[model samples]
Every structure is written in structure tokens, then in C-alpha cells.
Target: MCVRYLGFVLLVWFTGVLRAQSAALHCGAPSLSGGYLVPEQETYSHESELTYACDNGRKPAVEGWWATSTCQNGKWSHEPQCIDEKACIPPTIPNAKYTEKLNGWYEEGHKIRITCDEGYEQKDQDATAECINGIWTSVPVCERSTQACGEPPKIPHAVIIHQEYQEVFAVDSELQYECEDGYTVEEADGKKSIFCIAGSWTKGPTCRIRPGTGLGGSTVGGTHGGHTTSTGSGTQPASGGGGIRPGTGLGGSTVGGTHGGHTTSTGSGTQPASGGGGTGPLTRHVSNCGKPPIVPNGEVLETNRLFLKYRCGTFYKLMGPETVVCYSDGTWSEVPTCRVAYCAVDTDEYPDLKHAGVKYIKDGESLRFECVDLWLVTNYSEGRCTDGRMTFTRCCNKFQLNTNIC
Candidate 1:
């Protein structure tokens, strides 16, 4: 102890200034991530330990979690941490689809709810997947319901220009398309169609765009607010009854937020659509996009701008479109895909440890670990395959379950 500290303490004691001194070894209540601590303390004199537990919908990510932290001299020996509750991956089955898209990937303590597609029925089973400990417990399969064509596949940068009232594309039925502005149909093969041949539709042509129409030359309206301007300078059109020339339009999303609509120049009184649209109260129009994109083994995880968040199935990770915009023009900003994955565990590392299920687990797959009889486990017994990795608790078993090695 420093002489100054002792002198100050003596002065305070004699003057009664130490009367307001607080309890010894006072500390803030134990703080933990994804969980809370039991028996939070305000003051401590002797060494104490804290018990930790994950909150509802959360689980421990790593194995061998200590579950407790020690407090000594007002300082914690180690911090307690736990994983957030996870959800199961989207259920996958051939000739089937989710009844409704989900907002996020499956997680621990959550369930997958869905139904079979039209003309298809469950082969005497339920369409559900349970999320257990950050892994899917089971996946449902859907058999063929009908032989006719299911929903036509979605084409990027394009939409269904024509369809019947029933929307059923029966055998020999045909679907046509007209690409959105700034995008054009495949002119090479000239196959912009969906022909319901037999039970499946032929490969549909994709839409293509160059990204910009007019760049350098002054545009009637700049790309600031997704508006089109009429290129004019108080001049008349060419001798051929030329009115004001149309200005270049912007593509993708505009700064001012108008989309899935057309941009025309209102120059020279020849046209009257570019004089800055009305500022009157806007009326809500029906969404052009038919619900959000439901990618194969994925769902609309979140709604951002027009861009959406697409979460892949359990074990699988997303390849593209972390953000997408739902267009008012009945088109997807950019759809995403979910790629299959393999587990990230190294089986060779655990000698004498036996595992069942996939020797090398795949994403969304699970494996069980166990020790020989008379032996005990120090780490988690199960591992869930997710995104090329496994989230498991630590294991260290050098002794028997009920008896210590002495």
C-alpha cells in the first residue's frame, strides 16, 4: 500500500469522512451476451462464481461452455457467452414448395411451416421441419400433385406480359413477354416464350440491358430523381414535324424513388409527361411484384428498400442478392440463390470418438458423437452442419461421467 493512500485513509478515519464509504468490492451486475447471469451481485467480499444461461430462443454456440464465471477482487475470472436461438432450415422436397416464404433461415428453437404445391399432395405425411439446437430435425417431401405445369419459372429483368385469367399454363399453353424498359429480349435465338411441353416449360429467354441510355449529352432530367427530361432549349424539332426530342431515362432504381413505370419527355409541347409529375398526394397502387421472390430452398428473409433479403435453407448459404428491391413494375430487383454446403468439422481430430450419420456431414445435416462405454463426454454430443462449418460446444473428457480419474 502506498504511504499517500494510507495517510488519506487515516485522515478520513479521524475526520469521520470515511463514514460514506461504500460496501467492499462493489461491482456492476454480471453482464452477458445472448443470456443473463444468475445471482447478480452488488458487493463481494469473498470469491464467488456466476451461473450463466442462454435466453429463450438462444443456445450456446461453442461446446464445453463453462456456464459460470468467477468474481475475485471485484473482477470476473472469465466472461460467460451463449449463442442466440436459431431456426431450422427451409424444408426441401422434390416437386414441392413452401406455402409461404419465411423471413429468415431456420434457427434453433424455431419451426418450418409449409404445404405442398397444387395437384401435388403429401404422401401421407406432414409438411414441417423442426429446428433443434441450431439444426433441422426432419424435412418433409412432397410428391407430384398434378402433371400440368406448375408456376412458370421467374426470368430476371423480365415478367409475364400475358397470361389467362386462371393463370394455368396447360399442355400446349404458351406465355409471352415484353422486357422492362432499358432491357431487351434475346434477339439472337428469338425464343422469348414459355411453352408448356408435356409437363415442363421450355427454357425461357433472359432479358438483357446495357445499363444506360444517354450518358454525356445533357439529359432532359438528370439521374438525380429517377425522372426523364425532354432535351430542348427553346428550339423546334427537325422539318419533319419535329416536336421536342425525348431525353434519356434512368434504369434500375432512381434517386427520387419512382420505378416500374415509364419516363417520357414533355418537350416542345409535342409531349406533356416530363414537366415534373404532379406533387399531389400519391395513391397506393397494387404491388406489381407478386409477393417476394421465393428462391429454391430459400425465403424472403427481410424487406429492404425494394431490395429484399433472401435467406437460404439450413446448412446452405446465400450466393447473391443479400439486398433486393421489390419492383412496382411486377419485376424482381435481383433474385438470389442458395448453394448446398458441407460441414466444417475435421473427423480425424477426434480419435476413438465414434460418430453416426454422414461421416462427413453436409450442410443442414447432423452428426452424433459418443465415447466408448465407461467413458464420459466433456463437449457437446451433437453437431449441426451449417454454412461450411459446425457450431458445437467444446468437449474434453479425460474422466468417467460419474467417477473422477484419480
Candidate 2:
């Protein structure tokens, strides 16, 4: 230990001595005072410096310790430093039921499951609790089952076997009722025709019966015959046979009594009963003999426009007034009124002279013409008129003959 100390002290002294010697050597430039003094006369000041470092959690170790000095100064006095220590730690969540099952720390990416207690059903799937930042997500609740049917139905003439029945009933269980013998049975729409299906009973049906006499044609009582009977008065008994008198002279009378009247017969007549005169043969007379011949009102002047009219006894066409039909008595039907058919005259200057006087040329009418001794006349031969327009073929007169006439 003493040798080490001696070495450190020697090193310090050597360094100081070198600096002092360097300070004493004023070689090239003159001093600001303009005095040519030896380097041994120069003076030097010590400098202070600092370095930075950090401890556990502190700030800078040193503050405000730095200086500049001449090269002849001793080693730096002291170095400054800083101390800093910082770290991050995780957060904690409280009262989380299933969070503990997630290893140890609940960090950003942790997950956990949540479920309802027994006898309770979850509306959705089991939820997952996520550790977002530091808090656990909310847990969902469970719900219970619901009832099916709405209300019990009403039944007529028959009473329900039990009151306040369950909302759901089992299948194939029948509902029975009793009605009077003469009445019929009926039911309501939905509930009345209800059949047992699946686990629950459909709505109950209503009961009814028709009101009338009983079956077997009896009127409320079981009697087959009645005691009251009808009788006739002053006339032959309706139950037995009898005869009719000869001179009764009833229209419907026969040797026996008339159908609706009583009869009386005696043994005193001497002359044989004169037979009634035989009914004469039925006869009919003829009058107003021989039908008269029908005379037409007038004769048709225009053959194309003639219309016929018939007499009273004559038969004619049942439809239009234009047609005439003969009667069964061999006579022509009366003639209807007649009118002239007038047509418009065509005045177009046709090139063909032969078709000049033709009036109202119908469809499909055609004509050809030739010039007489023409001096080479053109557009004169083939021509036609359709819909009041003239179409003519090209023609020219080739020669001249007689100057007076052809």
C-alpha cells in the first residue's frame, strides 16, 4: 500500500513539473505588455471541469462546474455527472371472476371466459372477457323460457272438463262433450277444429246442435195414432157402395150414382127408358174463301237500285230491307221503293280519243288509241286513269297526209 501511494504521488508531481517547465519556456511571440521577459516569469491558473453519470433514479450528478485555462495549468479539479433510473410496470383489475385463470398478469392481449350459473340459460354464446389496457370487459346475463298459448277458448252447450288448463297440452288427448239428441254439433274456426299436435293442445272448439222435432218423426211424444175421426152427414156413407136414379140427369151420371152425388132408384116405370139422342158428329163451316192476289205498290225504275216490298200475307226476308222472299201462297212479295244510281262524270283530257265519252271508268278499265294521219304525234296511245289521275304512254306524229280531213 505505501508503494502504491508513492507511485501515485510521483506521477502527480511529474505531471505538475512538466507543466511548470513548459510555462517557463516563452519561445516565439512577445507578450502583450511588450516586455522581453524569461518564461520563468509567466503565471498560470488551474481549471475546473465536470462529467455526467446516473445512479438508480436520480438526475444529473453534477451541475455548473466547467472552466477554461492556460496549457500550463494542473490536471482538472473535479468532473460532474447525472443519475437517472426509470422503468414501466403493469396495472391491476379488481373483482374479475375468471381473470385469475389467465396466468398471472392481465395485460393488453389477455382473454378470459364468462358463463352463467346453473338453471339459467344464456341469450347468446358464452362471452370472452378481454383485458383492454387495464380494465376487464362486461359480462352478459342469461334469460328464462317463455310460455306459448294466449287464452282458453269458450265452448257452448257443453262444459269444459276442467278449468284453468295449462298453456301447452299433449297430443291425441280428446275433449268430449254432450248435446241434446235432436240438435247438431258445430265448432269455432281455429279453436273448434283443434287437433292435438306436437306437445301442446290447440284452442278448444265450441259445441252446438240444431233445434227441431226429434228423430223417428215423433212430435215430442211417442204416439203412433190419434183418437179423433171425421164423418159425413145426410149423404151416402163414404165407406160403402150405392146406386143412382135414372131421371137424375146429371152431366157426369152413369147407370150408377154420379161420382160426387147420392143416387135413388124405383120399380114403377112402364115405357122403356128412351135412350138419349146420340151426340151429332162435330161440324165446322168455311168462310172468307180464296186468298186475294197481292198487288205491288210500284214498279222499280232503276234496275240496279230496285228494292222490293211485300203485302201483308206475303213472307219476306226478316233482316235487311234490300232483300225479297216469296210467300207460301204462290205470290211474289210487294216491291220496295226504287231510286236512280247517279255517278260523277269524268272530264279529264285523255290522249286516247276512243275512250273520250266513257263515264266513271271503274277499276281495271283500260283503252288504246291511234292517231289518224298524224304528223308524227307523240304521247298518244297507251293511257290509263286511276283515282282521277291520267297516265299516258309516250307518242309522236311521224307524218302529215291530207290537210283538209282524214
Candidate 3:
């Protein structure tokens, strides 16, 4: 008797272990390029689906900006990929302008027409300017007319890049300039652009020494307390030093810096430290939830920093609230579950039941069952499905009229 009891206990324990393992099945995180998946997580439960959003000028391999993938037993049903949409940036032609309004970036195979300025003509009238594979092809060139502006003026500390050899430049012709080492053009963002006007070229920008060098009179250092200070009260440096004019600071550098740093310097001459490397202010958390939680067999319909709405898949009923609120601590309200809304029956167990081979009966739908030739059932002929379950009033064999055989 004791041996039989021990054997039964072992069998029950093994079944419980197997049930736990099957219930906890999950898939590892999936990776995507040129885009990111929503509701990112380290692991996802079985049969869970996720949607991804692509970056600009790129689309998922499947279709539009958004695509979905499902996590099967241990692998992804579809691997997500974001591919280049093959869009081209607007092309610039010297002494000419596009006829249509430039829409920033043009899709593949898009074409644009150029109209030369008053005193210029296209070098190749038959050339077609079109976008192909994210590049412009056969761009029209506007040749200079007899009545044109003189050669472009040379800047003191700058040189032309990819300068085309031309004796004369037409009105509205433009050129790109690059400043020498240790020097930067005034108000120029990396490239110095100059264009010809009615009869003369635009004023060329001057390049001055870059700040933060130990050789120049300007000194940039961090204080003992780990804060950077840029003072502009000192006298101007000699012509060799690349200091700013009387009261200006380095272009684009903000005083005090970002990430909660504070600036104490006065006057417009003050600026942030070079490279923004010095230690600054303490960081603080923002009151916002970056991503919403993933819902199996469901999707997020509306999303915001503090709230979101969820919807379940077809034939699945939601068991909790449709909307969830995010707290300041970044935790969300109780998430809902998408409960199955269909009833399934075993065909092998009830061969006499009519349509027992049917896959499933949707919620609120009815199904009829039959017994064997000599057996009869009362109130078990028709049953309605509900919430993954089905009920019948009675089940009995022909001889056991008063007993429920099932």
C-alpha cells in the first residue's frame, strides 16, 4: 500500500512540473534595424504580437511605416525589417530654379523641371532631371550667358570646394567654401555659401581662429567645483589669436549647458566649455511613460504620455478596463487580459455529436449534439457557447434515464 501511495505522489508531481513549464513558454527579444518595435521587452509570451514604427524615408519590408510580428512557440513568425524608401533630397542647380515647389525629399522615379535664370540657358535641353535610388540623375546644368557677373571673390582664410573651372559666372550662381584648419567662418554652419547678385558677388564671410586653444588669449577651464566658466572681460587678443570680436561668444554653444546645468556669466561674451565635456548639473527624471505595456491578442489604439487605450482581437473579449493611466513613477494601472470567447469540443470523445468536427463555436452561438442509436439525451441536443465554456441541461444513455452519463 505504501509503495502504491509513493508512486501516485511521484506521478502528480511530474504532471505539475510539466504544466508549469508549458504555461511559462516565451520568446527572447527581437532586433530590428532602421526602426524600433513598440512595447519593447526583454522577453515576450507565446503567441504575442508586436508592431514596429520605421524611421523617416524608410518603410518596413512588408508595407507602410507600421508592421507587425508574432512570437510563436520559440521564434518570431515574421522577422521585421526596415528598408530604404529610395528617396532623394532636393537638387540644387547654379543659376537656375526648379519649376515646381520642392517637397524636401522626392520618391524614386520622381522628375523635376528646371528654369534657367534671366541670362542663362540649360547646357543640355534634352536632359531629364529625375530621382533614382535616392540619387539625382541627369541633372540639368544652366550655362552662363554673355552678360554675366565677374569671377567669385576669394576669401582670406577659405578655399572653394569642387570648384568648377569657368571664366565667368552668371547672376545667381553659387559656390561652397571651406574654412582652413583652426579657423571658422563668421555665422557659417560648416559651409560658407556665396551667390552672385545683379552685377556682383555676395559679400564673402571672414574666418577667424577657433576658440578654446591654449595659444590664444582666450582661456577655457573648469572650476574646482566642476563647473565651466567662460569670461569675456579680458582685453582682445592679437591678430594671431582666434578670439571672438569684442562681446560675442562661440557660435551654437549655450552658456551653462544642457542637462540641468546653470550659467552664471553675464554679457553676451560668455559661452559653454568646448566639447561640453566638463561635469555639470545633476540629472532628474521626467514625469512621463515612454512606452505602453504589450497586450497579448490585443493592440494599443490611442497612446499618450499619461494614458492609453487598448483593443482586443476579434472573438476575444477584454477582461479589464479599456483605458489605462500611467503614474508619475512610470508604473501603469492594472493591465487587462484578452479572454478567449469560443468553446472547443473533442471530436474523438463525442463521435455521436453532430458537427463535432467543427473547430470552434463562437460566443453566444449554439451547437446541436446527437447520441447513439439506442441512447437518448434530454436538454443536451442544443447548447450555447460562452467564454470558452459550454453547458447542457442533461446527458444520459438510453437505459440510464435518471443519471447523467457525462
Candidate 4:
């Protein structure tokens, strides 16, 4: 039989007939089984069925249509099996190494850790690793550890007190010094004792005081002149001196009118006996007369004739014949006169006086006036010098008497 349906051709024949017939079909080979015939059309035809078997120890394929042979009598064709096409697998990080790979079936946010060996230090990320493509992006590096000391101690003029003598130092441990005997020990600038924190001390010394001489007296006692002597004896000379005869003076000679012992004068003006050496007067002759004069009560001593004069709170030497007499009150009798002893007179004279008594002028001349104080002369500028017959003008304001005049 021959049937055409939807442009596809199907050949119908018995199973045995189809097996024995040698026919050529274009779309696909014809299938004959029992009374039914199934035609293999182009759309449904299996060209060359591939049998699928997973390699590399992959999961086995499922049995149904994907695994069952398709042809009825002829050799059944196997179907292609479903495979895992995912190329990305979680990247592995070696025990001590870190990975940055991101490829994996793991959900996002998966992480891993990486670390270094005992003496080594991790240079890269030591905490977390990320999943990326099938391979890790980067491997972490491990390096050797480094040892270092902190800043050196700030001590000056002092040495560290430790066996190591390292640059860094701790607190509470001290730095020592070597000072002279009399001087005291003290801390150096900008430094303190080391603690147990980070460093140790090395070596240090202490301060001592220096001996000296001071203005205060020495420990041993002596006089300011540094001399020591016994009673009735002079101080020993710094150099040796010859011994003198027992009762003799400086020259070892017999004294006085007697034959042997030294003699010293006891009277105010007497000299030592001639034959014995004697110390002469060491002072000059001074008279108390030239010193300030002592004034006795009711008596007057004229200082103008003497050498010294006394005034208010001061003593002065008399340079000329100015008289300064002493009074009963120990004060000078005369008021201090400011006038010079000698003076020359010119043609100009003093205003004329009209007093009847004698008028003495400072120039050592005297005249008799008929008028007294406040009286003016009638002759205007000149006046008669008579015994008692002088005429006068009336008193005026310009010729008024000066009450304070001495």
C-alpha cells in the first residue's frame, strides 16, 4: 500500500514483506509491524542516532526515551544523554594559600580564609577568599617577620643600664651617673627611669663632690694673721732668728744706768734709757688748739685771732681778721657778717642823713646829722656837715624809716 498525508509519503507492507523487499525510500526507511505501518518522515527521522555515555565518571543517563533504542526491528538508535554543561567549578585553595576564584555552584557570598606558617607573615589577604571563574584569580603571598626596636630613650649624659643596651627603653629602670665627690647626683635633661615596657638599661655612674677652699675659716683654728705665740714671747719669725740674752732688748745691749737688764720708759715724755735699743714714738705731734675750740660759759674767745671757727652745725678755719667771738650759750657771739673786710669808695655817696648824732658809714667815715629816721635833707642831694645846725626837708613816703634795718 502507498499513502500520501500532508506531503509525506508512507509505505505499508507486512513485516516479513518489508524485510524481504529491496525498495529505496527518499524521506526515511519504512517501518512495518503487524497490520500497522509507521513511516519515517523527514521531520521525525533520526539520521544517525548517537549513543551517549558520560565520560570522566559523570552521572549515568536516564533510561526512558533518551536512553531506549528507537528502531523496532532494525538496530535501535540511542538518544543523546543530558549532560552538565556548566564549565565553572568552585576553585580550590591550598591549605596555607588563599584564592580569589569566583566560579562555583555555591551561592553568592561564599568565602574562605588563608594564613601563613609560624615564622612567616601573610602579605596579602589573610582573612577571606572569593569564588570567581573556574580558577582562582590570585594567590596570597607570605613573607618573613621583621624585628625592630622603638625610639631610643631621651636620656642625656647618662648610659643605659642593661646587658642588651638596645635603642628602645622601658619605664621604672633608672639611668646612673658618675659625679665627683662633693657634687650631688641628679637626673640628666629629658630622661627618666626605664619601666619593664620594651627596653633595658646598660651601664651608668654617679656624681661626687669636689673639695674646695671657702671664705669661711678652715677646720683647724688659728688667728687671722696665722701666728701662734706663748706668754711673754713674740711670735716666731717665718724664718729662724738668733736667740737673745735673757733680759736684753732688741740689740741685746745692757739698759739704763745699771749693768744688765733692759729698761722701758714709763713717763709720758721720758725716753728709754740710752744704752738699750728702744722703739721710738710711732705717731706725729698733734695740737688740739687748731681743732674746734671749746667755748666756756660767760667767756668769749675770738675765733678771728684763733685757727678755727664754729657756726650752726659746722666748723671752719678763719681765713682773715673776721671776728667770731664765743658766747655763754656755746654759740658764736657775732651774727655772720657777709661783707668783705676791705672796700673802695667812689664819687657816689649814700643818701644824706639829718640826724643830730654821729652817723657812722661802713667806709670808716662818720658825719653828724641834725635829723633822725624818716627825715629828708633840704639840700636835695647834698647836706651840711655841721656840729648840730643841719637843715632838713619834711619827711615823705620815699624817706620813710625802715623798721627792720639793723
Q: RMSD of each candidate? A: 25.1, 48.0, 37.5, 51.5
Per-residue alpha-carbon lDDT of candidate 3 for residues 43-115, written as tens digits (9 for 90 to 100): 8899998889889878765544598998888677767767677866567788788855333456688898887
For candidate 2, the per-residue lDDT at 124 reads 46
Residue 270 accuracy (lDDT) in model 2: 16
The runs of at least 3 residues in candidate 1 whose Cα sits more than 4 Å from the true structure, single-residue gaps closed, are 1-286, 289-294, 301-309, 326-330, 341-351, 359-368, 373-406
| Alpha carbon lDDT at 245, candidate 4 | 46
Name every residue pair that clashes in candidate 3: none
**Please, what are the lDDT tens digits per residue for candidate 2 over residues 1-406?**
9999999999999999988766654222212221122232233333322223333343322232222223224432322222221211122322223435322244455666544332233344334656563445554444321212223345555555544464443233454444445544443122324333222334343344454554433211001212211222211211112222346543111121122221212222112133444342211111111122222222222222112333221111122243343321223343343221212222234333432222332223443444322454432344455544445444433232112111
Candidate 4 matches the true fold with a TM-score of: 0.14
Question: What range of 10 consecutive residues in model 4 has the weakest lDDT sum?
Answer: 281-290
Q: List residue ranges in candidate 3 displaced over 4 A.
A: 1-287, 304-306, 355-358, 369-380, 393-406
lDDT of 1 at 383: 61
lDDT of each: 0.51, 0.33, 0.60, 0.31
Of the candidates numbered 3 and 4, which has the greater lDDT value?
Answer: 3
